[model samples]
Target chain A: MINEKDTRLSKAFITVSFIALFLGATAGLLQTLVRGGVIELPAGIGYYQLLTAHGVLLALIFTTYFIMGFLYAGISKTLGTLYEVPLKTGWLGFWMMTFGTGLATVFILLNKATVLYTFYAPLQASPWFYIALVHVIVGSWMCAFSMWRQYYIWKQITKKKLSPLFSFMAVMTMAMWFIATLGVAAAVIFQFIPWSFGWVEKIDILISRTLFWYFGHPLVYFWLLPAYMCWYVVIPKIIGGKIFSDALARLSFVLFLLFSIPVGFHHQLLEPGISHSWKFFQVVLTFMVIIPSLMTAFSMFAVFETTGRRKGAKGLLGWLKVLPWSDVRFFAPMVGMLIFIPAGAGGIINASHQLNQVVHNTLWVTGHFHLTVASSVTLTFFGISYWLIPYLSGRTLTKKMHKLGIIQTVMWAVGMFLMSGAMHLVGLFGAPRRTAYTTYSDHPQAAEWIPYQAVMAVGGTILFLAILLVLYIAYYLAFRAPKGETEFPIGEVEAAAVQTPIILENWKLWVGISAMLILIAYTLPFWHMIEHAPPGSQGYKFW
Target chain B: MPQLETNKPKKLKKAEKEQDLKGTLLSVMLLGLFIILSWGAVYALYLSR
Candidate 1:
């Protein structure tokens, strides 16, 4: 169990993450309404401003802070105490991220930075915006370093025994994130910061975009791996099952670390200047990353089947029926997996080079990501919050709250289905994304999108209600619920007869292989970009 | 007594293990089928366009 001080620190991170979710989700609701023609834009907040706030708060602030908090909890639990961690440095990281978030929030609110979440330059924000983001990333690095330090000390103490799976995974998550963020860190510090401050006359769009996506694509994995950690470690325990194969689980995470970063060019399939061969190579790598996910899907399903059958379930699909649907802990993440099926399918289309052209800038892309980050990732986070908040607060999750959680998850799914579903359909009809309103007075095609926009609005409304319910539930659990200790569900593997190989735990070899893969994927393309220098663009602020 | 007790439970455990393995293979097949069909449908949609 974590000490009180560590729990407090963890709570601080989680609390801020929820706060960001609330604010960012509010902005999303407004955008949905605006797009749906249900409401006009509120004064002083432009569409891009809202978009920037929504994306940054949810993607950057909410996910990062939540991951940090969850990892702290996982580390403390698995390592036997929080004292092994450098608590002072952990607190420092927390404050840095918090302060940086505050700084960026100010600029965003002031409309000083309306560059969308991508923050793609030559559309520059205030230099402080870039600087603020750097602070956030560096703070995250501090947290990652703290995990590394803790693991190092743990190994020193327990020389022969491998670290627990949860601790191993927590460290891996931060390590992968640390490596991935270096690309963006370099881009920000070297290029965007200087350009924003007027130290540079022009900035290279292609290089900046390339660098951003280099970080950007893997950033999804950063959000995902923690969720995967929860699914692998926590969900099986909740459902009364063991992990199918610990070796397979570790291998899957290792594969993710290797293949996740090198495939960013797939995001730029439509962009000019990058060689077609390089894009094709990256696309292949993107497909390779799917292997680990498929492994996860298989492992999870097998676990569920084993558990259900042991409980006396018969027939092929009988196992599904026996799994705990009433238990919100299992249900929420399970539903998340269900959504991920379609989300993963959509991802394949997005990665397919020729097919990608059809949906490149369309609302189809928006729909696809909504299913991914918005549904699969966010729902899992919500599921995690159900147990985690109460665990940190020293409170028991009530049955009533669990019921409410299930309802919230269902509402979110329904809303996403209606909204994202409509978005996908409309995208097929050629509706563009990133626009406040698609129904142009002059364009005949715009009229066709209005109905879908309305569906999106309705879906957004339902989702907003669901968000409100979640916030209320979280608040009630943290502050009002009766105090009690909660268990951190860490499942065992059923096939205990088969021990995970000692070689699988060799982080040094895996990291080396990951680096080699990244080098192979990136070196030539990066070299080409540098050698064939194009004239950089001057900063432009359309918003 | 020890030999008889251990042997009976061992037999039961083997049977249970077989059942679990069968269920796993069945689940995998279904999941694979779903994945292939979904991918095929999406690709076919794109090709049709």
Candidate 2:
């Protein structure tokens, strides 16, 4: 069990996260409706404004807060209670992040920062928005340091060579976050803040974009690794299986840390100013990151097969039938794992330089991430919430709540299928994303996209309903569920699993390699961009 | 010669523990095929465009 004091901190973070979910989902609902021509917004609230809120609140605030809370709980549970210093640090981080979120959110709501989540250069928001981002990143850094300190203390006390699997994964996630955020931190502090504040008259658009994406690409992994932690560490226990291999899991995570950061140029493959060679290089590294995902897939299937066979199941696929489909804890992440097949496929296509031409800046790209982060990652987060909330709150997930959770998951899957499916199809037909409802003066091709938009509207409405259900369930679990113990399900490794090599625990080696890769991948291209730098442009407030 | 003797039983033990999961093999193969097919489809589109 997690300590009572630590639970308070986790509960606070989760509470704020759910609040963001409600607000963000509401913004998402409005966006779909507006884009579908089902409704027109009043002049006071613009589509871009709602879009900004949707991205920031859900993609940034909800994920970060939820991840921090979940990591804290797992760390406290596995590494023992947080010491006074780290505990206080956790609280300090929580307040700062909350304050930053509040400040950034207020600016977005006022439409002063309608630059969308990427907040791409040449478009500027209030200086406060950038400062708010700084707070959020630094605040997360505080939590990351605290978790590391806790792990270090555990190692010192126990003198154990290997950290607990969950804590190890947490440190990996936070370490990657610290390294990845440096790019965005540099961009925001040096370029964005000063430019927006008029301390600088102009900004180097290419450098700013290069830096943002340096953070942006790995930012997705930061969101994804926690979900992976659940898949690798927690799901097997829920399914009555042992981890297929501790060494394999740690090795895959190590690979992710090394490969995920240096591949940022895959996002910039189409953007000019960066040479084709560098983009191609990053694309190759992006493919290298796929190795770990493939490893994860193999490991997952092996775990299921081994467990089912041990249960006396027979036949090639008999193991699938033995899985606990009725349990929401398993069902939610099970569906997520299934969705990731296509999501991972789509990611490969997106990073492919030539194939990216077919979908870049299109609704297909939007549809792709919706499948990945929204469906796969978000569903896994919800699965974690089902147990983590009740466990932290000292309550039980009653049968009724379980039923509701399943219904919510189904609703989400169906909604996503309609919305994201239509997006992918229509985007192939050249429908642009991030635009308000328009027939382009009734052009014939533009008219073809109408049906898909309508379908997306229907999907969005269902998704909004699902969001409401999730919120209600969160409330019920936190306050009304019967007082009882809920197992914080963490799986054990199989006895026959190979011993995790001590090299996997070597942080300096991994981080150093990661940094070296980033430098090699970026150094010359960055120097070129600076040397041949075009004159900077003053910020625009097109909104 | 000494190293080979020491590693011999270890290799056998490793092989013994490694189960040939036919279903997992087929599943991942199918996953790989899907990725290839999707990439090919998009590539064809890129070519056409």
Q: For this target, which candidate reaches the highest DockQ against the unseen true structure?
A: 2
User: Tens digits of per-residue lDDT for model 1 on B18-38?
Assistant: 667666677667767777786
Query: Which stretch of 10 consecutive residues in model 1 chain A shows the poorest summed lDDT?
Result: A80-89
Give each model's clash number.
Answer: 0, 0
What is the TM-score of candidate 1?
A: 0.96
Q: Across residues A129-220, which tens digit of lDDT does each residue of candidate 2 receive? A: 99999999999999998999999999999999999999999999999999999999999999999999999999999999999989999999
Docking class of 1: acceptable
Q: Considering only N, C-alpha and C atoms within 3 Å, which residue pairs clash in candidate 2?
A: none
TM-score of chain A considered alone, across all candidate predictions? 0.98, 0.99
- Model 2 chain A lowest lDDT segment of ten: A353-362
Best by lDDT: 2
What is candidate 2's CA lDDT for residue A109?
A: 87
Fraction of true contacts kept, per model?
Answer: 0.45, 0.89
State the displacement of the C-alpha of residue A360, model 1, in Å, after optimal TM-score superposition: 1.3
